[model samples]
Target chain A: MPQLDPTSFSPQLFWLAIAFILLYLLMSRLVLPRVGKVLGQREERIQGNLEKAVKLKAEAEEVLAAYQKSIADARAEAHSALNQAAAEIAAATAAREADFARKLAEQTAVAESRIKVSKTQALADIRTVAGDLAAAMTSKLTGVTVNGSDAGGAVEAVLKERA
Target chain B: MAAEHHSPLEQFRVEHIGGNLSLGGYDISFNNSALWMLIAVAAITVFMLVGIRKQAVVPGRWQALVEFLYDFVANMLKENVGNEGRKYFPWVFSIFMFVLFCNLFGLLPNSFTVTSHIIVTFALALMVFIIVTAIGFIRHGLHFLSFFVPKGAPAWLLPLMIPIEIISYFIRPMSLSVRLFANMVAGHVMLVVLGSFVLPLGLAGAYISGIVPVAAITAIIGLEFLIACLQAYVFTILTCIYLNDAVHMNH
Candidate 1:
């Protein structure tokens, strides 16, 4: 084959060295560095973005936790407020009921004392009338005079015997 | 037809560009092979330079292609040579891109295939071999010679195995060079031969018969393109494997 031709080998090698070395220099010095920089920049950017995303996510989670805690606190506060209001209302009602009961007892006691006084007066008036009536009847029936003190003494003895 | 008059090997003929230029008793004339190598280098330089001109974080199409190639070589080195390979990224990357571009460019009609020449491929292979061997020696000193001896073997078998090991180690450059050179030459020769058949077959019989060779040539051309890329990959990975062996010196 022409490739195996001995005379062609040197020239090929000579140019190969020249071309390849130049190419290598171009790559290592200029081309690769620029490409490498861009690639490295992209990777760094991606990594930075990912880290930022993670940080933001963590922050969001923290805020959510705080919000949840606040909600729980508010709920507890509302629950305590409701219980306190119920207790206060119950206490107020109990106090008003007790006051009303005390006032009712006082009014009942006054009414019972007034009824007792009126009954005693009514009994004394009845006793006086009966005594007078008894004296008059005695005088009319026997046609004899009866003394007031004697008639009172007779009514008193009859009342004592009946008691 | 003229197709039958032409030789398939004609394409590989190296013609001088001008008078020979020699230095130190050497003929270093610029030729077709040299011209293609320059073209390949120039093409790569332009491609990379233009690709990164914008340097946008969000890459355009060309930038994406450039980045893809960069990552491709980077990953290859990482996989083969580990972190230590980072230092050699430029060398490995240049080899891959140069070989790949040369192979692809050669597929163009009437273009020279630099890799098809034994001198070029052999030079690349020899450079790799020499460098790798030097690395082994430098890292391990004289202990690098122990690489040929099997770790666990019968004492009697050392007589038989050591030579085989040594021969295989020495055969690396030859194998690497021949594999790439043979593949390129075979593919191109097949394309030419198949293409040459179209005209002669047409003149011999029905014009419709020309379609057969034409279709075959088309198919082979596609296959050649795939092979070109594949050979470049094969060459690079093999270089990596050899480098790995030298760097790590595993049995």
Candidate 2:
């Protein structure tokens, strides 16, 4: 085989050396750097994206917390408002009931006073009538005129004894 | 016509271009091997230059291919040589690309396989051997001599084991170079031998008798392509391993 032949060895080695060194320089100085730079840039971009995602997630959580806080505040406000409304209604009902009771009591007192006045008037009429009757009867029996004032005094004394 | 040139070995002949040129005693004349080497270098240079010209953050197809090769070599170095191997990335990468391209280009019609030549492979292997040995001595100083001493060997076994270790250590270049050269030579020889049958059979004879060799040639070509890539990988990883031994000084 010509490959086994010794004559071709030196030229092949010389060219191999030159080409290899040149290729090494090209790759190390130029090609590899460019490729490495691009890869590094991609890695940096992905890392930055991940960091942004985390930051955005934190911001979303903060917003969600604020939203939850507002909901709770509104719920508390609604509860207090409901409680205040309930208390006002209760107070109004109590005040209305108290006014109603006061007015009813005043009417009862007026009615009782009217009944007392009527009762006293009725007793006085009865007393006058009895006194008149007694004077008439006494005058008729005795065939003489009886004094009204004396009859009234005798009726009053009899009524007081009966009581 | 085919019977006249039946030697498959003829394909490996390195004919000098433009007569022989010698500088002092050295035969520095440009030859077929040199020409192919230049072609391989130019091809790689162009491929790299065009692929990386854009340097896009989002890589185009060519740029992606270039990046893929770069990362492949980088990862190989990192895996075999560790982080300290980062400094040797360019050399390892160059060797891998050069061997790979040379092997592939040799597959073309009438092209020379530079790696098939023992001299070329030996040169590469020798360079790696020298670099690794220098690194070993530089890192470990006189302790580098201890590399030939097997750990856990009894004092009486020293005489037996020491020579074996030393010989094995010295044989690294020969093994590395021969492994690549032999694989290339064998594959190319098979291809040429099988291919030689095709022309001799003629068209009518090919229909009658050439089917087997043709099919074999096709299959062997595919296998050769695989071997080309694998051999390149093997050569590079072995270099990394040797470098690792140097750096770590592990027996």
Candidate 3:
């Protein structure tokens, strides 16, 4: 075979050495370093982006938590305010009712006292009218005149006997 | 071309190109093999350099391909030789790309296959052998000689084991070189021999009969392509394994 012919061997080796050395130099110096750098940079960028995403998500979560807490606080404040207003209204209603009752009691007591005095006056007036009528009737019918005291004493004795 | 008597061996010829020249008593005449090697180198350079011209964060298809090959070799070295093997990446990558492109280019019709030549393959294997051995010695001093000694063998068994180990270790270059050379030579020879039959068959019988060998050649060509890739991978991976052995003896 032509391959076994020793004459061709050295030249082949020579060219191979040159080609191989050239390739090694190119790859080691030029190609591989750049490729590695690019890959490393991409990886770093990806990692940075991931970290940023995580940070943003955490911030969002914090804001949500704060928002929920504020909502709860507002609800609690509103409830307390409503309770306080209701309590105040109840207290005012109770005070107003007590004042009205006290006033009504005072007016009721005055009216009762006035009715008692009127009742006594009406009784006195009735007694006088009865006395005069009795005196006038006796004089006209039997021609007997009676004094006020005599008639009063007679009415009292009759009133006392029937009592 | 059809009128000429065809010899399948003609393809293996390495005729002088440009002119005959000698350097230091060796007839280092430029030949097709030399041209092809330069072509392979140029192709590799362009593939890598142009691919990364953009150096994009998100790679385009060409850049992705380049990166994929880079990662493939890098991972192989890592898996085989661990972290210390990192320094050897350039050499391994160059070897892989060089062999791959040469094999692929050789598949072109009427092309001279560099790897098919025994001397070329032997040279590559020798290069690997020398590097691996040198590394072993440099790292471990004379302790590298202990590589031939079996780890757990009985003292009596070692007498037999050591020489055998030595022999097997030395056989590496031959095995590595011949494997690549034989595969390439056989494949090309078979292709040419079958191809020579095509015109005769077509002229002798119905033209349709010629399609049989043609179909076979087509299938085998496909297989050859696969073999080319596989061989390149094998060559590189074997280099890694050898490097592993040298870098860490016995374990």
Candidate 4:
């Protein structure tokens, strides 16, 4: 076989050494660092992206929590305001009703006093009429006359006895 | 129809190229073998350099291929030789790429296989042997000598076992080189002999004999392609294993 030729061995070895050393130097010096850098940068970028995503997610959750808390607070405030308005309306209505009742009682007391005075005046006029009727009838039948003041005393005696 | 009946072995011939100029009285002439070696080196360089020109974060196809090969070699060393093997990446990666590209390129028609020669394979194996032994000695001092002495043998059998161990250790390079050379030679010889039969037989008669060789060459070419990849892998892994032995010295 031509491969067994001793003369060809040296050239093959020489070339092999050159090719191999050239490849080794190229890989070690230029190619290895570039490739390693690309791979390393890629890893770092992916890691950074993932961390950013996590941070954004946490921020989003925090905002959601705050939003929900504000909603609950606003609802509570509205509820309390509603209750306070209802209580104020109830107090105003009660005070208005109490004032109307006190005014009605005072008007009722004034009407009662006027009604008593009218009743006393009506009794005195009746007593005068009765005393004149008695004096007229006695004068016509037996020629006798009586005063209103005496008649009023006699009527008051009769009203007291009846009461 | 008559045609040249070429010798199947004629394909292995080494011819001088460009009127070979020697230097310092050594016949280091430029030949077909040297030309192919340069092509292999060029191919490797382009595959690496141009493949990463973009160096995109999301890699293109060529960049992915480059990274894949890099990771493959890196992982091979990591598994076989551990972290201590990191320093030897350049040598290991270079040899792996060299042998792989040479073997693959040889499969092309009219291409010279660089690894098919015993001299080339022997030189590579010898280098690996020397480097591994040097590492062994440097790491363990005289304890590397104890590598050839078995631990569990009886006192009487120690003499026989030690010599056997020494012989085995020395045979590593021979075995490594011969295995690669013989495999390449055998596969190529088979393909050439079968290939020679195809065109002539097809034109000679109405018989289907040519089809048989065609089918066979097809199958064998596929097998040879697989062998090309396998041999390169085997060579690299073996280098890693030997390096492992030197670094860790379990036996």
Point to the candidate with the largest DockQ.
Answer: 1
Provide the lowest-lDDT 10-residue window in model 2 chain B: B199-208
TM-score to true structure, per model: 0.90, 0.83, 0.81, 0.74
Q: Of the pair 1 and 4, which is ahead by DockQ?
A: 1
Residue B202, model 4: lDDT of: 84
Each model's DockQ score: 0.65, 0.59, 0.58, 0.53
Candidate 2 lDDT by residue in tens digits, B1-251 = 57536687777889999888776687878999999998998898889889988878788999989989989999999998899999988889999999999999999989999899999999999999999999999989989999899999999999999999999999999999999999999999898888877766646573667777889999999999999999999999999999999998775
Sequence-dependent TM-score of model 4? 0.74
How should the candidates be ordered by DockQ, best one leading? 1, 2, 3, 4
Give residue B21's lDDT in candidate 3 (0 to 100).
Answer: 82
Candidate 2 ranges with C-alpha deviation above 4 Å: A109-163, B1-4, B148-164, B200-208
TM per candidate, chain B? 0.96, 0.94, 0.97, 0.94
Q: Where is the poorest 10-residue window by lDDT in model 3 chain B? A: B1-10
Say what the RMSD of model 1 is: 2.8
lDDT of each: 0.91, 0.89, 0.91, 0.89
The sequence of per-residue lDDT tens digits that candidate 4 reaches over residues B6-79 is 66667677889877667687788899988998898888888888988897999999999999998999999999
* lDDT score, candidate 4: 0.89
